[model samples]
Target: MTAVEPAGLAAFLAEHPPFEALGPEALDEIAHDAHVERFDDAALIHDGFKEPTDEVFVVVAGQVAVLWNDSRQASSDPDDILGPGDVFGFRAMLTGRSLGPRAVACGAATVARIPASLAGPAFATRSGARFLVETMVPDRRATDVPSYSSVDDLIEREPLLVDPDTTVGEVARWMTDRGVPAVVDLGGGRFGLITDAVLRARVLVDGRSASTPAREIMDTTAPVVHLDDTAAEALMLLLERDAEFLLVTDRAGVLRGVVCPRDFAISPITVGVSLHEQLRRATSIEELATFAGRVPPMLGDLLSRGLGAGRVIAVYSGFLDTIIRRAIGLVFARHPELSVDAFTWLSLGSNGRREAVLSSDVDSAVAFDDAVDAETVPAYRAAFAEVSGVLATAGLSADGHGTTAQAAMFSRTNADWRAAARQWLAAPADHNGAMMTSLLVDGRPIHGDPGLPAVSRVFNDLREHPGTMRLLLRESLAYRAKLRSAWFPARRQETFDIKTHGLLPVVNVARWAALSVGSAVLPTTERLRAASGSAMLPADSAATLIEVFDVLQRLRLRYQIRQYGAGEQPTDVVTLKWLSPLDRSVIAQAVREISAVQRRMDNVSNYVAVEEWASPGRA
Candidate 1:
C-alpha cells in the first residue's frame, strides 16, 4: 500500500473537535490518509453521490458555499457561505452515508479532508459523540428535503377554497374549519381570493348578504408571482403591484401558488394601520406629542420592507403630517377663536420633499388669507407659536432658519407670500435670499391646501429675471464630489462626506431643474425623472441624474438598514470605512458618474462663482 500524506490532513484535524481530541500519533496517522484539494472560483468541491465518511474538511484559504444534492441545477455562491477555519463534509463523515448537500469553492482556495477510518473509535467515544452521530445521520434525507421554490414556500397555499356553486354558508364554514379568515373562489381563474378583512370591510361592514357569491368579494385581479422569485423580490413585487397576495403562476400562467404579506413580508402593514389609529385616538396635544418617538421605529420598518426611497418618504411624510395636523386641530380646538380655518400650512425642505429621515427638523410655514387684518394675525401667530413649541417638545428639532409655521416671516397670506418672493427676486443679490430660496424651493403643503398658484407665480418671475436662473443653477452646482486616490497605499488620507458628495448634488440639481421647468414634484428621484422633459436640464443629463439618484438612494437604504440594526439613526453621512470592497467599488463608480454629470452641468451654465476671500495669498 502507498504511504499516506500527513501534513494536509494534520492541519484539517487541528480545527475539528473530535479530531483534535485524538492523541498526536493517531492524528498523524489520520493526516497520512488525507486528501488536499484546491478549487478555483465556481469550481465544484464535491458531489452528492460521495459516500459518507468520517473525513472532516477544513477551509484553509478563501471561501466555500454549500448547495443541495442538485448542485448543477441549484447553486448559489455566498448563499451558503463558509469562511476560513469552518468545517465542511463533517455531517457526511459522521453519518456513514452519502454526503447531504453539495459544496463549491467561492474563490481560488485550498481545502484538506481526513478520512473517517482513521478515527472511527475516537468518534464513537467523543464527548459530543451524539452531535456527530446526529449530524452524520440526518433524520431527513437530502432528496426528501423541501425545495425553496413552492406555492407554500411563497404564500399561504392552502387558503380556504370554495366552489363557484358553494353556498355562502359553506364558504363561511370552510373558513371556520380551516381557521383561515379568508376564502378563495377557485371557480374563476383570475378573481378568487377573499380575505376575512375583506369580509369585514365589504360584507359585514357594508351589511352585504353572506349568501352572495364570493366573486362579489374576491379580488380576481390581484397580482401573482412565480415560484422561482426570491422572497426579497416577492416583497418588492407586493409593493409594486399594490396587492397583499401575489398569485403564484408558472411560466404558462398556470396557478401554482399564492404569496401574501405574511408569506414573505419582513414587516407588517398592521404596524402602519395601528400607528394611524393611535394618532386618531389621541385626544390631547400632549398625548399626540408623546407619540412622536414612535415614528422612527415605524419608518425603519417601512424602509426594511424594501419600499422605494420615494414611497418610503411619501408614506412617512403623510403620517408625520397627519400628526402635525392633529396637533394643530387639538390646539385650535382649545383656542376656538384662533381662526384655524383661515390659514394653510407648509412643510419646507426635506419634509416638503417627503425625504425627511428619522432625524429631520421641522421646516414649516403658515399662509393666511387676506380676510384677516394685522391685528387678528396676532392670535394666529400666538397659536402657531404655541403649536410649534409643542412640536419641538414632541422631538421635532427646530429648523435652522426658525421657519416653522410659527415664524412670522414665513407665515404670510398668498398676496404677501408672492410679494415677498418677487421682492427677493427683484432685490440685489444677497446671501439670505439665496439661502432661504434653497429651502423654500423644495417646500410643499403638508397640513393644509397647497397654495401652489402663489409659489408658481414667483418661480415664473424668477425665471424671467436675468442672472436669477444663473444664480439658481450656480447655487445648485456649488457642491462637488470629493474623491480620493485611496487605492494607492502611499496616497495621502482623505475623506469626503457622501451626503454632500453623493446625495446633495442630485438634490440641488433636481431642485434647480424643477424650478426652471415649473415642475412641482418634491422628491429628488421624482423631480429628476420629471426634469427629463424640462428645457432647463439637458435631456441626457436628466436621464443620467435619474439613474444616479436611484443608485444613491439604494445605497442610502442599505446603509440605513445597517444603521437601524445597530440602533443608529439614518443619515447621508455614509462612512467609506464601513462598506465592503464590492460596495466601495460601486460607490466609487456612482460618485464618478455623478461628478461627470456635475462637470457637464458646469459646462452648460455659469450659475454661480466659487471665489474665496481669505488670507492675502488666497484673496
Candidate 2:
C-alpha cells in the first residue's frame, strides 16, 4: 500500500472543510509533519484497551474501520468505517479520553496520522472547531447524561419562608443562626435568597442599615430547581450559574426547600444493592409481586424529579429483569422435574429496546438449548406457562400478542429459533412473517445465557436482509398518514394517543435504519445516534428524531405519573391541559419534527444504503 497521489496533502487539506478554514500556512504545517502508513492487510491501528492516544488519523486511501469493545481483539466486523478524507480519534483526543473504540485498517490502505500538538491549532479555528464538535463526534457521545437523585431526596430541612418586609435585624439573626437568613418569598412565586455573603456585600460594604427591609438587600438571582429536579440537574444548574445554593420549589412553583452541592446523596449504588438483595430473597410469587409493585412509584418519583425518560426506562427494565430472574428460580423450585435447564428468557418489543413506559405492554419469548428434543418440548410447555403466569401474577401482563413464551410458536429449541429467523428474513411479507421478524429484531435476554447461540443471533439476524428491512419500512407507510391526521385535532385537548403518532414512528424509523446497518443497539435514542454514524439516515434527521423521542418519553412519563397518582390506570393517552405553556409548545415542536422524520423515512434510499456497508471509500 502507498499514499494516494490524487493531489499533494496540502491541496487536499485546502479543499476540505475545517482544514480549509485552517488557512494555507497551518495546512502546510499539518501536511509537512503528517506521517503516512500503509497496511497491505487489515491490522489493529489503535486499541481501545491500550494507553490513550493524543493524535488523530485521516483516511488517505482505502478505509479504517471502527469497533467498540473493552479487550483488544482483531475482528472483521466494523461498527463504522472512515473512508478517504474522513477523520477519526479527535473526539477522544479533544475530550481527554481513551480511544474507547478500536480502529483497524481495512485491507490495503493508506492513512495519515497527525499529532494533536500540530493539528490542535487548525482544529481551534472557529469553523474548524465547529466541524470537530458537530461532525467528528457522534451526538450521543457528547451527551452529558445526568445521574439520578431529586432535590426532595437531598434537602435536609424545610425552607423558612419569611415575609419580604421582615426586619434586616431579624434576617441578620437568622444568618447568625445558620449561614443565611430564611428566604424572602417575593410573593408571585419569586424568592430572595439571603446569605452571609449577601449581608457582607449589600449591608456591610454598601453601608446599608440593619433596619432596612429584608427584600431590599437580599440576593434574588440564586439558581432555582424543582423539588423533583435530579441532584445532577441541580448541580449542573448551580455550576452553570456559579451559585452557592439552589432554591428548591414544588411542581406548582411554590418554594419548598434549599440545597447546596454538599447536600447530594452519593447512595445510588447502595440503593441498587439493597433492592437487588430484596429481589434475591423474594422466594414467592406474592413476595416478588410485592417488590414489583414498588416499580411504578419509583419510576414516578424519577420522572417527577425530571430524570430523562430513557434513564428511567432503563431503571424500570432493570427492576423487571431482577424480578424475572427470581421468578425463573421459583419456577424450577416448584416444578423440579422440568428438563429444560439451559434456556434464555427473551424480552421483546418496547421492553427489549429499553423504551418501555409505565403503561407499555410486556412481550417475551424463551429459547431452550438444542439438546432439548421434540419429546421434551411438550414437557417444557408448563414451565413456559409458569414463567409468563408468574410475571402476569406480578402485574406484568403478557401483551405479546399471542407470541408469549406460553405459546408453542414462541417457546422453541435453539435450532428451531434460528431456522424460523432465517425463514422470516427470507419472506417477510408472507404468513405474518413481517410481524414475527420485527418482534425478534430487538430481542434481548433478561435471564440465563445471553450467548445461547441462536437466541442471541436473533438480535441482529436481520442485518444481511436489507430487502426485508426495506419492505418493513415501506409497509409502515401504509397507515402512518392516518396517525398524523389525528395528531393535530388532539392538540390542547384532555388527551390523545401521542404514543401511536409521536413515539411509534420514531421507533420504527430508528429500528429500520439500525437493523439495515447491522446495529443491535437497543434503545431508541441510541438507535438514532448509531443510525447517524452509519449514514443510514442524515445526522440532522436522526438528531431531530432523537430530540422528538426524548420529549415524547418525558411527556408520556409525566402524564402516566399523574394518572397513577390519582388511582387511575396509567396510559399514554394523556391530557395537554395539565402541561405548562412551554411544555405544550415543546410537544408541538416535537410533533412537527416527527412529521419531518416521517417524510424522510418514506424515501427508499433513506433506510436502505446501496453502498457496501464498510467499503474502501465514500467521499
Candidate 3:
C-alpha cells in the first residue's frame, strides 16, 4: 500500500462498522496491509476456483452482488447485496473453505481488501467480537431470554371465572375453594377483574352486604395484557395504570388469568410491592421506616441484575413516595384535628421529577388551603414536622436549603404559594429566585389535591413573559465553566461532581426548553420529548440529550451503589479512579453534548431581549 493509500483506507474504515471497535493503532496496522481493487459491472471480484480465499472484502463504494451456484438450480439473482460499511466473505475465510459465492460489482465500485490474518485477530478482541456477533450472526439461543421473561411463566394456576350477577358471598366462597387470589368476571361479552384486596377494601371495609352483586365491586377498567406479553410490559402497565391486578387475555380476548404485583415480586426491584403493602398496613412511623430501609438493598439488587439506571431510580423513588405518604398518614392519624384535604404535600427537585437516586435529599413543601384559620396553623405545622422527622428516619435527609416543611418557607398556604410564584416570576434573577423558580417549576404533588391546574396557569403566565424566559435561558447556560473543566482529566483528577457537571446541564436545558414551550412536564426525559414535539428543540438533539442524560444518570448511580456497598457515605463527587475508560469516554461525550445544547440556546437571538436584566454582570 502507498503512504497516502493507507490513510485513505483508514479514513474509509472509520466510517464503517466492526472497525469502530478497534483503536487507532490497530486500524493503522490493518490499513498498512490493505489494498484497494476496482471492479466493473458483471466482473467477478473473486472466484472460488481461481482466487485464494484469504481476504475479507469491505465495500468502499457502489455495491457488490453475491451469487451462489447449486446443483439443483442456478440463477442470475443475487443471494445478497453488500454496500458501504458492509462486510462480506468472512465466513468462508474464517472456516478455511473455498468461497461459496461469486462476488460481482453491480456497477463500477471500489473495494478494500484486508488479509484475514489481520482482520481475524482484530475481530477476536472483546469489543470487536461483540460487534461481529451483533452485526452478522443470528443466534437464536441468545434471544431466548428477554430482559423481562414472559408473563405466562408467572401463572401457576388456572384463572377462576365468575358471572357478574354472582352473590358476593358465593364469589368469595368460590375464590376460597379455587385457591386463587383473584377472579375474572365474564358477563355481557366484557371482562372485569376482582381481587381479594379490592374485595377487602371496598366490600368488607365499606360494610357492604354479603349478598351484593359482584359486578358492583369489579373493576371494569383493569388493565389487560396478552399472555404473550413480557413481564416488563406488564410491569409498565401496572405502573402506568396504577393497578394492582392486570387481567391476562388471549388473542381471542378470552381471559386467561390475572397478574398481580406479587407476580412481579420475583424480580429484585419488584420486591417493593410486598414492602409497599407492608407500609400501607403499618400503624406507626417506626414500622414505615423499617420498610423504607429495604429500598437500598433492593436498589443494589436491581443494579446487579443489570436493570437500567433510569428504571432503578424510578423504582426507588416510588418506594420513597410510598414511605412519605404513609408517614403523612401516620402523622394525620396522630393529630386527627388536621384535615387531609387542608393541604397538599409537594415533592421538589429530583424526587419531584421521579429521577432520584439513593443519595437524594428531601426537598418538599406544603400548600395548605386558605380556609384553615390561624388556630389550625400550629396543628398543621406540627403534623408536617412529625412527618418530616419520620422521612428523615426513613433515609431522606432534610434539605439544607430549607425547602422542606421543616422550614417556614416550605410550609405555606395556597395563597402564599401563588404570591411567592408571582414574586419569583417578576424578579427571577434575584437572590435564591433562580433556584426557587427551577425547583418550584418541577414541584409535583405527592399527597392530597395537586392543584396543578392553578399552578400550571402560573407557569403559562411565566412562559408568556419574555424577561422570565430570558433569565431562565441564561441560568440554564451558566454551566459553561463546569463543561470546560470536564474535558481535562487533571481538572477532575481526584473528584468529579456528576450532578453539577454531568446531570444539571441536561436537566437545566430540558427544563428551560420545556418551560419556554409552556409544558408543565417535570421529568427530564419527558420534558425533552415535549419540547421536541413543540418544536422548541429539534427531535434529534432531544433524543441525543436524553441518551446523554441516561449515560450520566447511570454513571452516577453505579458510583453511588459502590459507595453504599463499601459502607461509605454516598456523595455527588465521584472519584476518577473508580471509572473505566469507557465510562470516562461516555462522561466526556455527555458533557460535550450538554455544552453544545447550552451554546445553541445562547445563540438563539429570537428570544426576548434581556439587555436590561441579563447584562454581563448578571447571573
TM-score of each: 0.53, 0.54, 0.59
For model 3, how does the per-residue alpha-carbon lDDT over 1-619 read when each residue is reduced to its tens digit? 2134787788878767667756788788888888777888878887643455888888888899875443212577876788887777665565455534567889977888889887775553433433433333212111222333457776667888887788888888888888675554574436876767678987999999999888888777787887876555466557545675678877667778876654543321233344555665677877777878777877776666455678778767777777888888888887766688788888888999999997799888888888878687877877778888888888778788778875777777788778778877888877567777888887888888766314435776765577777777778777661534445656666667889888888888888777776678888998988777333366777888899888788888888889988988888888777888788778777777877766665764355253322222212
Clashes, model 1:
8
The best candidate by lDDT is: 3
- What range of 10 consecutive residues in model 1 has the weakest lDDT sum? 610-619
Q: Which regions of candidate 2 fall more than 4 Å away from where they truly are? A: 1-273, 304-306, 453-466, 478-494, 533-536, 604-619
Task: Give lDDT per model, in order.
Answer: 0.63, 0.69, 0.71
Total clashing pairs for each candidate: 8, 2, 0
The most accurate candidate by TM-score is 3
Over 1-619, each residue of candidate 2 has an lDDT whose tens digit, in order, gives 3554434888886776557766677777788788878876568777744667788777777888776554324545676877888777665665556645677878877888778887665554444523432342222232232334566886667677788898878888876776434789887889998877788898899999888898898788887888765554454445434576789888577988877633432212123323444665797889988877777777765654445676677667766777777888888788767743567888888888877777877787888887766786776777777877888888887784676877888888778888887777789788677778678767888777777837445546565666776677676544341233233434435555778866887887877777766677888887777777443467777788888788778878878878888999888776667777777667677777777666655552553475443221321
Candidate 3 similarity to native, TM-score: 0.59
Q: Residue 218 deviation, candidate 2, in Å?
A: 60
How well is each residue in 1-619 modelled by candidate 1, as lDDT tens digits?
A: 2222476557556666556656778878867666777888988777544645556676767888776444444434333577775666654554445644566788787776656676454543322232232232212234432222233354544555566555555677777777554446463355377656577777788887868777677666576666654443444445434564567766555566655543431112234534554665578867886676676666556555445555555556766676777778878888987777788887887778877665567788777877768888878878888787777766677677677777777788878877777766765266366666777667776555555427435765555665676777777888876575655535623444566777788889888777665666777876777666443455676777778777766677667667876888666677667877676776677778888877866754543232210001210
**Candidate 3: regions farther than 4 A off:** 1-269, 426-433, 451-453, 481-492, 533-536, 606-619
Ranking by TM-score: 3, 2, 1
What's the lDDT for residue 97 in model 2?
A: 65
